[model samples]
Target: MMRNQTSSTSQTIRFTLIAFGLGVGLTTLVIGGADDATPIGTKWWPSEFGPADERGAANRITPKKVLEARDLIQDGKIYQLGRLYEHGMPIPGKRHFSLTIPGLPTGLPTGNNQMVSNDELVSGEIGQVGTQFDGLGHVGCRVNGEDIFYNGFKLSEFGNPYGLEKLGVENVGVFLTRGILLDVAAIRKADRLPNGYVIKPAELQACLDTADLEIRTGDMVLLRTGHGKLWMEDNDTYGEGEPGLGLAAARFLTDRKVALIGADTWAIEAVPHESDELSYPVHQWNLTRHGVYHLENLDLEELAADKVYEFAFMFSPLRLRGATGSPGNPIAVR
Candidate 1:
């Protein structure tokens, strides 16, 4: 049941069975209650990193992990897994991305050497746009009038109009770890998984088995749905719902202690989510509950085509003091 991305909230509750499964899993025991799908105000914080921690899953990138990843780079072939941030690129919802040169030559010749330059007046959610890396502060749960973020930090206490005091993207250091790409589209023998298609643990496991690969702790897992094929060609279709991981599948990765989850889809989790009671539950689960990061809107076509299931994945989020997220190109080395 692929729902339009612009559909109303009430129109998305088409999967009662999936929604029920979500409730049965990590969510609350009750299924239909307001707080059942993703419980609010419960004790899901103080993260494993401790009360004051903000660096989330990047904490898993130990020196040993770096060495492990480095060993996978035999050929030194690099795959850029980010899309171009230009106009007409599909942006989720009302988010905008625009880059313009203020003038033909923003700067005139200042010296005898003729140093003319064109500066860009870039606007629109720099951190949240393009190939975005969601930090800990990007999503939170509202509990009884209070917003709780990763480590159970209160939004009222740390959030500022200027920037957040905690869980800033800057707090997350570099990520260099073994990467595993599960080409679900190929395993399913489809060019692209249908919109609203929920990828479960079974599908992920099947892909791993087919590739003779197993996910390891601290690994960066990426999914290729083939939806990225629509990237610039069909912006309208791309902005619509997408196929991605479901809650149960996400739990599977988090249980393996994965450092991050990324996908070709704009939202790594399925749209018209498994539960109507929840919106982007996977985001809340990964970022807020488990301190795991998410890499969205990735470009994985080349990797999928090459059948590069294993590689060294590395990315460093911009050091934007208190930004909730960062946009940049994450690379995979083979």
Candidate 2:
């Protein structure tokens, strides 16, 4: 975990609040005493969407929500909020992203015509690569001798070698709602927050106050930490760790009933983690506990630079049947 120190970026810092730093909330929650039979009280099963619900938070995108989102558009200006999917981008563990064209023409010329074609094959963890949408089926906690996913769905039902049969990316509909960018780096008076900086609830409130914007239910919130500036420029350092929401911050957004949360970093939660025992606790807290989805590896630089704090954000994940996630570019318009 990187300590809170003066970042090397040229952008001047504004807010002088001490960096909340890392390893904050994990100590109080777990006593290191729970067994497999012990119930996970984190909010699972019998969702508000009903027992058989598969779409999770996407159900919040009702017609009423659509109209509300459309109302935010004024100048018709759109900002692309997804990052480029290229070979050099940093990835977690053994995952990767790459593109290639097999041959010169890539395909044969048309008969009796001058038309030739080029086609490229994309190879990578399609659902997990750049600018990805994490579905309910994507995360779960093991308990009672089974791996439980969203709505207590077991791995035996949806987990498959080919694709997930349930809670797949196809189950999620679309997101069209008010997008709020909490530019934490800008608010903290830093071009980029140091790695492992755990964003606290106090910082979030200050950010909202700074923007004069309040987070409403079903809002898609984006946290801009400026970590993305290293994207494609330095893959190794980018993959090391990141500055993001702590457990407290996760609870803050989840309690507000936000449909989805995105960020400029790879994971929405702080890297190196607040707890070494819990694997992606925020992912579980939102996806399993409350069904709030997460969008990671986003590009919010343009939007941040323009100071577009609030706008209409929309993105449709490709309906890849039985896939855990979908790769696509999300857009924000003001």
Candidate 3:
């Protein structure tokens, strides 16, 4: 047999226990924080790195601006700043010998054996030769400890499983804009910047001062170190030891929001540090982290000698979908 107590205090105690349990359930509803089920508006927040009042709004130059620049060039006041490719000049790092691929046919088909052609149609797999611009997608940092696209896209996501349809060389669009050439070598009083010599931030500023040119938004900055000539010497020591922009220099350029930064050298940054543990931090910082494009192996000797600092730049890269990079010939007219 059981005895039942129907007192007001007992009823109140029962109600209190139920209330406490309800309070705990409510607490969890409040403290769980916006889960996947939470409304999107409830989780919205302002971006931290967005444009500030002092800083101008983020803007991109339109095609009309480029066309306006071209119109300025038509005023008959611009000189072309690009190297003429020669047949026998020594290709960098390949010794004094000129470009000649063995087992490759040469000459056009003419006469009896019309089916065969000897001409190496200037096509096929030719290691990027001559002045070239490195596209933004050229090099990338490992994302999540894996070689992935900068946009978090997997490498495999490009193209069809076995065919070129998915990722073909036709994606990189044309680029035309105003170009500013910073003649660092001339300012340094040296014919060529030495290898391993890190260009300091102060020196870069000095070069800009000497040039007396202002860097505008959406401009491509080309830094001439006189190292291109050295590279053309075809000596291993040339590229093995050459002066290049330091990490600070790269930072300075990117801070200006320059669309692209180019140099007349193999790698825009100084030689790899002595410690094997240290690698190309500039590449990781600018190209990967900052979204800045790096243009390497530009031939700027002619332009520097001409003392042409401002120019209209034009370049079109092969639109290779999902390609790490496309070879480009960038021309500067001033």
Candidate 4:
């Protein structure tokens, strides 16, 4: 039988789970900055790791945490939690992803051995396409005519076309921690949520209550809105605004100390944003302010189908030095 998602079940979580603190240091930075897009006069510089640290929330994955996560793998079953990178996979404005080969047998036999090989040319936003991981440098805001990134580092100082000098995807180490899949779709008893749906804190809390789950500190929390069902079926419709966490939901999750947030949608939060003026406030709230990470365009259907709420989430972004993001297949083991 499925876990009963009723008010009475809330006590199940409260009784079984212990509150975990964000063990990582959180040293706030005082910088001069103000914008309608960001918190007024707020900054996350002089990070807990130090003023120059770049790993962000990844610091929460300690050796002890890894061992704990390892113990969760009892059945040795793994669920591939990433979308397939292809020609039409719901890309947003101006972003692109394509793979081509000049010819099936693009290579010719040059040596006497007569070895034939096939090669393909790949290009177009690999870091942010398909199943993508957003880095600290992926999003930032213009502050007083200066572009600032995570930890309040100036863009002029670290931004480079070739690669970032600081806050690059290379800085975020591997993530092998606890993962919780919040099946909001099942909670709503719907195949998929309507576009532009804003998930409120009460809904989130109630979903946790329904799932009999708790959001532990430093955990990688993924929200399955059932949007992945449209992944390859209707690319255009999927590209449109999606149902996801609202700005309020972002604040609530940040307070819970989740190290990362993933979703089947392109953007982790609601598109068109809460206020017309804000584009990606949640990105700024987590990636910049609270040092949290984001994994987008995931494939959580298997986990949801099996009702696997908890697992050992594992992902190691490609060490693509200075890239803003990384594309890879994250896995969840139960």
Compared with the true structure, what per-residue lDDT tens digits does model 4 show for residues 214-294? 887788999989877888999877877788887568778888888899998888877645554445656767887778999
In candidate 1, how many clashes are counted?
Answer: 0
- lDDT: the better of candidates 1 and 4: 1
Flag the better candidate by lDDT, 3 or 4: 4
Candidate-wise lDDT, in order:
0.83, 0.78, 0.53, 0.76
Candidate 3 Cα outliers beyond 4 Å, as residue runs = 1-61, 71-129, 156-169, 273-276
TM-score (C-alpha) between model 4 and the true structure: 0.86
Where is model 1 poorest over a 10-residue stretch in terms of lDDT? Answer: 1-10
Between prediction 1 and prediction 3, the one with superior lDDT is: 1
TM-scores of all predicted structures: 0.90, 0.88, 0.66, 0.86
Q: 130 in model 2: Cα distance from truth in Å?
A: 1.5
- Comparing 2 and 4 on lDDT, the stronger one: 2
By TM-score: ranked, best first: 1, 2, 4, 3
Predicted candidate 1 versus true structure: per-residue lDDT over 1-334, tens digit per residue: 1122332133212323454556425443233334433243245766788888898788999999999999999899999999999988877667788889987799988898989999988898888877999999988877555878888899999998899988888889999999999999999999999888999999999999999999988999999999889988897887778899887898889989999999998889887676556677778768888999999899999998899999999999999988999999999999
Rank by lDDT, highest first: 1, 2, 4, 3
Best of the candidates, lDDT: 1
Each model's Cα RMSD: 3.8, 7.6, 18.5, 9.6
| lDDT tens digits by residue: candidate 2, 122-239 | 8888888778888888877666457888887889877898888889888888899888999999989999998888898888989899999999888999999989998988878787
